[model samples]
Structure formats: C-alpha cells, structure tokens
Target: MPKLRKAQVMILDGILSILMAMTISYVLFAAWPQHRETTGQLALERAGYDIVNAFYEDKEIYQTIRKGFEAKGYLSASEVEYLRTRLYNYGRMLGVSRIDVDIEGSEQFSVEVTHSTPARREQFTLIMPLRGGADDRIIRVSLWE
Candidate 1:
C-alpha cells in the first residue's frame, strides 16, 4: 500500500473515531430494556406487578413484601387508582389503561398484559398457578408513546 498523506490520514482517523464512538454508545445503552420516563407512573406499574409477584404469585417462600409496597412512600393513592383502572375482569381484554393478553403460548397456555397511557405494554414474567405447576409469559406488549 502507498503511504498516506498526513491530511488524508487525519480525515480517515476522524471518521473511524466517530464510527467507533457511535457503535460503543449504541452497544452500551441498548443492552438493557427501557424504564419509564416519569417516576410516579413507573412506580405505580412496578408496585402493582411487584405486589402480585411478591404476594400471590409465590412459588417459593419468602418474607412478605406486601406492606413495603403498601407503605405511603413506595406508592401513592394515585398509583393505586392507576392499578385498579388497569386491571380487568376475567375474560376481558382492553388497552384503555388496562391489561390484555396480547399473545398466547403453545398448548393455549400464556399470559397477557396491557397499559393504555402510551400503547400496548408487556413484561417478562413467570407465572405459577395457585394450585401447582408453573407457566412462563410468552407474549408481552410495549407502550408505543
């Protein structure tokens, strides 16, 4: 190869550096899933789901986490209201601030969740029936906004 001139070398180096920086940044930030922007809304969603998984969905034994989320600091009444509004009755599906089973699993076993404020929303979850056995959430929704 021919020896490169100083100006050409500097230009190539600049382009390479910019590309490397962009690639590094994308890799670093893209690894983890997204978190909600507003703390209150996020807190409400986390608190609701956490409450369920901690309290009712336990396949294993552990110290109760109910009271902690119920405490005034971790969650607020608005959050409670938000959760209440989001939950739906059996055999009902809606996205107007509600949960929906957007997808099903093979053998007709699956889980569904929905959040209306943004768009369809979902979470990666493990579900254990109250009686016995365990199920995994297959299809999860995401907020569009």
Candidate 2:
C-alpha cells in the first residue's frame, strides 16, 4: 500500500466529519415532528389541568357545584347549563374550540361545551375530585384543539 500525503489524509478526515455532521443534522430534523407532537400533547394536558383547576379554585363555581350536590345528588339542568357556558368561554380564551366535560357521580353526565367543525385528532384528559362531596365524585375534562 502507498502512504497518502498529509494533505490527502486531512481532506479525508474533513470529509468524514462533514458527513457525520450532516447525518446527525438529518436525524434531528427527521425527529422534529415527533418532538413537536410530544410538546403539543404536553401543552394540551397542561391546559386541561388548568381548566379543571380553574373550576376548583373559583369560589363561586365551586360553591355552585357543591350546592348542587347538596340539593340533589347530581348536578341539575341549570347548573349543567352554567358549566357549559363557562367552559365554552374558557375554551375560547384558551384557543381550544373543542371541549368535553363529564361529571360522574350518582349519574354520568356528559356535555360538549364547544364543538369543532373538523374534529381534532389530539386530546388530553384531566380527572379531578369534586370537592365538598360525601361520595367519591369525579369530573373528567377532555380538551382538544
């Protein structure tokens, strides 16, 4: 075998390094969508959690639901309507057009606050305890863009 000149060896190393960098860049670019999807899912999950937390944190809303539970074992029609309106407004503020809320207690009640023209593919759910209730009542909030 013939020994290569110093310049030729350097050129070969440079070419190899460039190829390695390009491969790495391509891999990262190819994986970008997956990373974005994961981030989007996380944001949706956070938004769901925030919406549920908002319901819990607001004294008026909390009292209304608790009052409903006290008056009737489950939410009344009026109370459900109020929730629907509030959720719809909140969804608009969050830039999420589709939201579904399910309250499970003595009876299972489901309500769709805002309807998306074209259904969203991504969704996130948050399950929270209904405070001030004797029984184990849970509110499930599902959000989609």
Candidate 3:
C-alpha cells in the first residue's frame, strides 16, 4: 500500500510539472508579438523626434525662417522648395515612405512627400523661438514607414 501511494504521488508531480511548462510556453508566445510591436513604435517615435530636432538645430533652417519672418510673415517659393527638398532627403535617409512637415510662424507652411506604402507612422512637434526669442514658432514632423 505504501508503494502504491508513492507511485501515485510521483505521477501527480509529473503532471504538475508538465502543466507549469505549458503555462510558461503560452505566456511567452502570447506576449512576444506585443513586445515586438511596442519596440518598433518606440523606434519610430525616436526617429520622428530626430527629424524635428534636425530642423530646429539647423542653422540654414533658422536662417530661412528668419528670412520669412523678416519678409512680412511669408516665405518665398524658393525657400519653401528648399525646405521641402531637405525634408524629402531626410525621409529617404531614414527609410521612411512619407514625410509631412508643418511650420507655423508668422506664416504657415506645409510640405509632404509620399514615396511608398506605409506600415507605421509617428509624429513629433517642437516649439522654438525665432530671432532672439521675440517670436515663437511651431514645427511638426510626421514620418511614415
């Protein structure tokens, strides 16, 4: 009778161990895709911020914006083209399929370029003062992957 009881106890232990292993496997597999998607979104967010920051820190961009502000609240066609081209190049370098930039200063400027299909998208906005902090401007960049 003692031996019989021992056999039953061993079988119960084995069954419990198998159940635990199955539970662990299910949890890991179920969460794997969510984890991957979260990481991808984080990367896209970082990229969007980088694009916005580039425009903020660029001397040429500042110069162009200053020129617009000085010109009675409007940017010239050439200045707009220059900004559009620069944004397109940045999008290309970052492997993005589309880029949209919105600049709000003394005037509003918008530019967009679409090159391919998009699988993900992220946007970032920055506010910076122009011309010695006398005026503030908003720049928003959206990147599509």
Candidate 4:
C-alpha cells in the first residue's frame, strides 16, 4: 500500500475527528423528533385531491352536471341538494369539521355547498374539471378541520 502524505493524513484525521464529535454529540443529545405538521398538510391536500377526482369520476355527478349545462343556465334545486348531500357525507367520512364544494361553470353560473364556517387554517383546496374532456365546468373542493 502507498504511504499517505502528511497532508492526506491531516485531512483524514480532521474528517475522523469531525465524525467522532458528531457521533458523541448525537449520543448525548439524542435525535430530534421531526415535526409532522408538513406531513399532515400533505395528507390533507391529497385527500382533497381524491375527493375532487371522485366528484369528477362519479357517473351520477357527471350526469347532473351535464344535464345542468345542457338545460336552463344552472343546476336545479334537486341537483344542488344532491351535491350538498354528497359533500356533507364525504366530510363526515373524513372526520373533518367542514367541507366546501364550489362549482363554477361557463356563463357565470356557480353553486356552493358549505357545511360550516372553516377556520381557514389547515385547509386544502383542489380544483379539477367537471368532465373528462374539455369542459367549461370546474369543481373546487376544500377540506378543513
């Protein structure tokens, strides 16, 4: 084996000293507990996205939206009620205090279903097209605790 130069030896010693110091400090102080707030926010956002996708994919919801678009300018009372019920049920299933669904379509037609006033903190909003193809209708789902 080639003999290490003095400079190489000094560098290796410095690296080893740093490693030892780090190990000792870790052993004495222990590992810090990671904060989960960011993780929770990501999960909340994911749930909101899933809810919006469900709304986009559901056949009944699609039919209602399509009919409303084809018919008189906006959704009927029954259709609005159906959407509200669905959003409320989803909120309950997710164990969130409130969930809001806002539907906006072309021609300035909009419908909103809000169960309760949200705290505004720890909320996630997801927006997606109402139908699969190029559709004027878009849905926004907000989930908050």
TM-score of each: 0.26, 0.59, 0.64, 0.57
Q: List the candidates ranked by lDDT, beginning with the highest.
A: 3, 2, 4, 1
Scored by CA lDDT, what does every candidate get? Answer: 0.38, 0.65, 0.73, 0.62
The Cα error of candidate 3 at residue 82, in Å, is: 0.2
TM-score, model 4 to reference? 0.57
lDDT of 1 by residue, 1-145 (tens): 3456877898999999998887888798764446857555564455445434432444221111122232321334444333333433211332224332222331212223433244434443434222122322233332222
The per-prediction tally of clashing pairs is 4, 0, 0, 0
Off by over 4 Å in 3: 1-38, 105-114
Question: What is residue 112's positional error in candidate 1, in angstroms?
Answer: 12
Candidate 1 accuracy as lDDT: 0.38
Model 3 steric clash pairs: none
The local lDDT score (0 to 100) that residue 74 gets in candidate 1 is 33
Better of 2 and 3 by TM-score: 3
What ranges in model 2 sit over 4 Å off? 1-39, 106-115, 121-133
On residues 94-145, what C-alpha lDDT tens digit does candidate 4 reach at each position? 6566665566753222223345555443434444443445556556556675
How would the candidate models be sorted by TM-score, starting from the highest? Answer: 3, 2, 4, 1
Q: List per-candidate RMSD values in Å.
A: 14.9, 7.6, 6.9, 11.3
Worst 10 residues of 4 by lDDT: 106-115
Native-structure RMSD, model 4: 11.3
